[model samples]
Target: MPNLPKKVRSKKLSSRVDLTAMVSVSFLLIIFFMVVGELSKGKAMALSLPEKYENGWHHWGCGSGSNERTITVLLDENNKIITYTGFLFNPRKAPKEINYGQNGIRKELFNQKKAILEYSTALGKPKNGPIVIIKPSKKSNFKNLVDILDEMAIINIETYAIVNEFTTEESQLLASK
Candidate 1:
């Protein structure tokens, strides 16, 4: 045997993992949370009952109710004005025709105003009434929402509301319970 020197041992080095995948996942999660947060902004408000008058008649005047007359405006999925009902001339009468075509929203709004005037005259009350009640679907478009608001302002409907829809089943359950 040749010269057998002292044996030397080499220490093994630990391997390092690349954190690229982890970084990517974290970024994706951040983006998802941000989007969700944005989507839920300004949707936490509560709904209150529309106001009723001293005589038990409710009028949504500028979002207040005082037992008078009211107009209910329903916005559909497309954000287009879908239905305008309640008090064409009196609170008891059915609403007039509602045409929701591309150019018909304004036309219908004018008609609503006319109907309001007629109703006020018939009832021997002041022509000025409370705000219109706007029931917009949750998924309504922002543009449509703005347009409706503008139209309400133009028509001098100072009071209004943005209400959520109610399912028939939900109503029935509540009624039963």
Candidate 2:
């Protein structure tokens, strides 16, 4: 019988998975999400606050029937805006819901501003712009507030304020319409 040489067996080598690509991809995803979250953040609006006090807080003008130089806008749901020249108790212009746009609130503001300027001129007083009071209701969204602020800016109104507190009458008024 011929002698046969036995074949030598080679040792098995273990295969390792490289996680470099996965790690890189994960880092990139994290960074992308972080950037997206930052971008999705709400942008803030700039506000200019008045001094401590003013001489014409409630009193708009000196002459009678000429004090309709101010208007209060109550923002409600679905872009509903309730506007009045004075308080709901004794409104100079009355409480009525107006639309939102150049033809709606903008035109009203323009006419009111024009009337105020004319009144001041007739009274031989300075042409101070009309005042606007913005009251955002509970049901009103941020967009509505922003739109009103934009209108105020578009009208070039100098005196305007965002009031958080709402009176009972205002609440009822907003609920009615």
lDDT: which candidate is best?
2
* Cα RMSD of predicted structure 2: 7.8
- Name the runs in model 2 displaced over 4 angstroms: 1-66
TM-score, candidate number 1: 0.47
lDDT value, residue 155 of candidate 2:
88
Write candidate 1's Cα lDDT for 65-87 as tens digits.
23234566655554444443543
Q: How well does each candidate superpose onto the true structure, as a TM-score?
A: 0.47, 0.63
| CA-only RMSD, every prediction | 10.7, 7.8
lDDT of each: 0.57, 0.78
Q: Give model 1 RMSD, 1 decimal.
A: 10.7
